[model samples]
Target: MKRMIFFSAVLGIGAVSACGGGGGSSAQPIAIDFAPLGIPNTDQEHVSYKVTDKLIVTYSDGSKKEFPLSYEVLLQSGDQMGSYKWGQLLDVNAQPMSNIAYTKGEISWNPDANSLIKTSDGKYFIITHFEEPPGMLYASELDPNTLKVKSITPIDFSSVGGTIINCAGSQTPWNTHLGGEEDYDLNSIYSVSAGGKNPAYVQCTKDSNGYFTGNDVNGKSNYFCGYVGGVQRYLKDLNIDPSNGYLGDKFNLYNYGYIVEVAYTNGKWDVAKHYITGKYTPEMAVVMPDRKTLYMSDDGDYKGLYKLVLNQPQNGFNKNWCGTLYAAKVKQLSDQNGGTFDVSWIELGKACDSEVKAIIDKKPLLTDIFDVEDPSACPTDQGFKLITEDRINECLRLKVGQYRSSKFASDDEVKKAAAFLETRKYAAYLGASIEFRKGEGLAYDPDNNVLYYAITEIGGSMADGKGDINLPNNMCGAVYRLVLDQNYNAYKMEGIVIGKPINRDPNDPDYQKYGQKWACHPDYVANPDNLKYIGYNTLLIGEDTSYHINNMVWAYNVKTGKLTRIAWVPTGAEVTGVFAHGLVGNNYTMTLNIQHPFVDTFRNADGNPVNSTYNDQNKDKRKGILGIIKGIPAGLLKLTH
Candidate 1:
């Protein structure tokens, strides 16, 4: 999470002396440590709050202050869905759709990201995204004092044709929420066929122009092949009927996979999809201080690391959707400790959002851009290049000359469309390294001119020792630190915090004593997902993994090279939406969400549910939580060493 640092006037560094018992002499910096959470007992299943229940602050004068450390639950998923303001699907006339299920059973309980927006009038609203097939976003008015929900208003995405799998997001520098759509449907866009899942949904066949010939594709009984099928499901969930004509005649795959900006204006929420930000399964897009440059993390196996630089820096990124897209091609420096790399950018293409959106509006098929053939049958003599993208080996050749569409005047125009529309495949064709596995979260440290990128796991093509990324399999994952240049472009990367893999056998000598049955070390972070930069030397990491019984949130001090566990979730839950909202009063607060608890599907060695004990202890198995950890002293956040 990227946030603007807030320094309290009352608790500034100058006030340290006043906090030191009003002494005339200056006080030394206070020493602070968050007591780490211990490993859960063998039979333990619920959340373990073994970490000290207090924030201990020791002054140079030997005086100590202990503030209670507790999590304040702001909203629960089940509770929100059961409320009146939970929101319902709207029709073409903007009226709530009737007979639609709005209960907890009908809606998803997975809360992924939270962006707290403070309006100019001192009003606070948190935009939360639910990770579901048909994703949902809601604006909850938060009480400034307690950071609790006062009212909930569902943000309508019907204007942008709705979104699917809304994942991790960041609060933009312009004070709006920038969300991502994790559209994995693109991976199978060329493979899945019409009526593959349900024959009753088959409507019409594609014409020679690649457009639907008959019936409304958004209709309940209408189904299209590839990416369109995914969009059909999303529309169906929204209760959109064929007769209503809600994107029923013209549905495009490119519209669904991009960065979405949501802003509260004049007491209403407005949304826009930024087509210029390329298309991929984006986990989060972190904007640099320049505001025009963005580093977006692609969340999938064999994906590319994307960067977008908006042309009009004076107007900032939100002004217009015109940018130059680039992907990283990394040369491995070493394979030790999750590997190090020398990173260089490969310019994909440049175009405005409207230009690409116009091409997308045509509803072109995958074959319209490139000729794709199986790797084994690739005709190298015919200029086909063998490339691995999305872990699929394919022979691809960009179309040219007479093969080009008349709508696009030049080959450059078609290339630009291909660059933004089929980003991953196009990057591979352009020779950009696309072997990253499970790229998760991104955080920029402007003070150090560094960017922190988290790779949730290391496997697949990344460890095959045949591609750009050749490393040992480390399912435990690692957080990489990228050194950026004056232009905010990452040039070098190395693993800063790497998880240690251990024996998983219960009979192992270390298993009984240290609870090392998990694949990764229990004391350290595994599958680091959401990251929040706190202070000058601390980075907060949240986990989303099955390596450990309980997902944890850890604080790693960059200066000290120490990793301390700050919090953990109930069994089978991910620690997500980790945001460090700077000083609130005299104390600092950080927001976190526990997603999908007590729903462990991963099994233990004995073939029993890994969180069976937890399920037995807890009654509700599908509720998620939005909470905050308060009582952190402002002084702690000012630590430079």
Candidate 2:
């Protein structure tokens, strides 16, 4: 086993020289080394959670200490070890909440993001986010010593509408949980081109005459009605009927895609969505040390990288969600590796939550914001611009004068509403680069004044040899480091780590030698999704990829550029909820989850199907796991501050 070493200087410590020549001299710097786990490439190894790493700490006085790296399975999917079962749905009052029969069973087992928080009153809680159509959040009170779940209660979002597709999140500097909603539903609602209707949209928007109206086969009128269908389905899943015309009475498309914050105060939990962050499908939102600047990753192809700078910086973000949203326009500096770029901010207007929410209340459709025309019939002689957004090409002109409805007070109001409601389209209309593919997770390093952003894949518009981002296709993806200035604005981005692509043919010589058949090298990171900067020059990266047979969790030393495999998940399972909780009690701990095991399939080098050996207590392959790697020494994770 190859060992990884961490160095730290012993300050203000002097010792007599061994040669007895000098009276006193500064002691040598101490080094802490650890053995890393091996890569899992074989059948048996692919279906197991393996962590064979150990930490050895050496002192300048010739003394040494060693601690074995071990993980504890805190909660597994479907485990009824607490008041509420792991991943189980519960109402705000701790009562069981029902779901539709088809999705009820599946939503109870998918756990994505985990935020371990310590309150000012010396209480500890873990906030877990469930990724589903109508996403949910659950808070569990933990016994600080044993780290066991004492009680569990689901955080209600009924007041702030409802959150969907809750994915990766981060803990705020103000000691609150900030979660994300990956709202792909926006893609279906705003699709306007012919033959571009989503099947789910077709099924959801039946007219009053009991016929599908907003479908590609039929004339595409009322395409926004598809969003109503999604809300109706979510309500039905919650065992609530929408026969009372709840779709028209409530529910808005702009309400779902913002960052949600969950804070506990006065013995109650409060939830609020940051609408000022600009609505989009966010994978994760991470705040800089300044507590006002935020970087959010948009999780799909041809999406834009967003940044929000809160107006009232001293008051903090949670207190005031009002901010200015900006999109990144990149200039490719180099095409080598995964590519590097010079980043410039494109101001995408400014608005508060109240201002944007008032516009959403009017229920403005796509046509209300812009006059849409077919791509071929675009009137270039007029003021129409041909733009492609969400894979649909259309000619759009901002609605002004008497061209739009009487809902807006002025044309300025219409533009302000479009800035927040149709964020990606408006950014594109303003000439901002909206061509990033699979932007996943974000991590900030306060000491270094830099931010690390993860790109799961480098294909799609990113590699199309046009526009702002033009690079070679590397489906294995890469991680880019952005250099931040004093004001928390990023000026340059460089690829620090890039994955290696390999031949997936089972009969290939490389596949036979590596004992695996996958699209990416098993040793390097494939589709790096969730990231956690655990101080001491280390960043933990979790994989969410089908390209790699067995997904892995790696610890990369940013200073030394050393990548070490720390853990592995079962076949077809993604390593999610990768959080580094520093110095919980006497030990440093990290939380990670295995989500949706066996949901995908893998093949061996011999072209034989490989199945997972992971059998939870329920003997089901569809379950997930929420675990913690405990006993990490404080010496291995000393903060730079």
Report RMSD (Å) for each prediction in the order shown.
6.6, 7.0
Q: Over the stretch 1-641, how does candidate 1's per-residue lDDT look in tens digits?
A: 11000000010111122244312244443555667776665555344322235655565777766556655556555454334334233333334433222113334556777776777676777677776545677777766565556887777787777776678888777778888887765442333232232122233334343433333345332322323433444454323222222234435556776888888777688888888788888887888878788988888788989999988652323525788999999999999988999999999999887888777777655556766665677798988788877666767678767777665678987898778888988998988999999898898876687899999988887898786889999878999999999989999989989886665567866555544336567877788998878654678898887777777888888768899887777676777776525433344445576676765543432334456666567645455655555555555554211
Model 1 Cα shift for residue 591 (angstroms): 1.2
Off by over 4 Å in 1: 1-32, 42-52, 56-65, 80-104, 191-230, 233-250, 314-319, 504-508, 514-517, 583-588, 603-609, 616-619, 634-641
Clashing residue pairs found in predicted model 1? none
TM-score of each: 0.84, 0.85
**Top of the candidates by TM-score:** 2
Q: For each candidate, what is the lDDT?
A: 0.66, 0.67
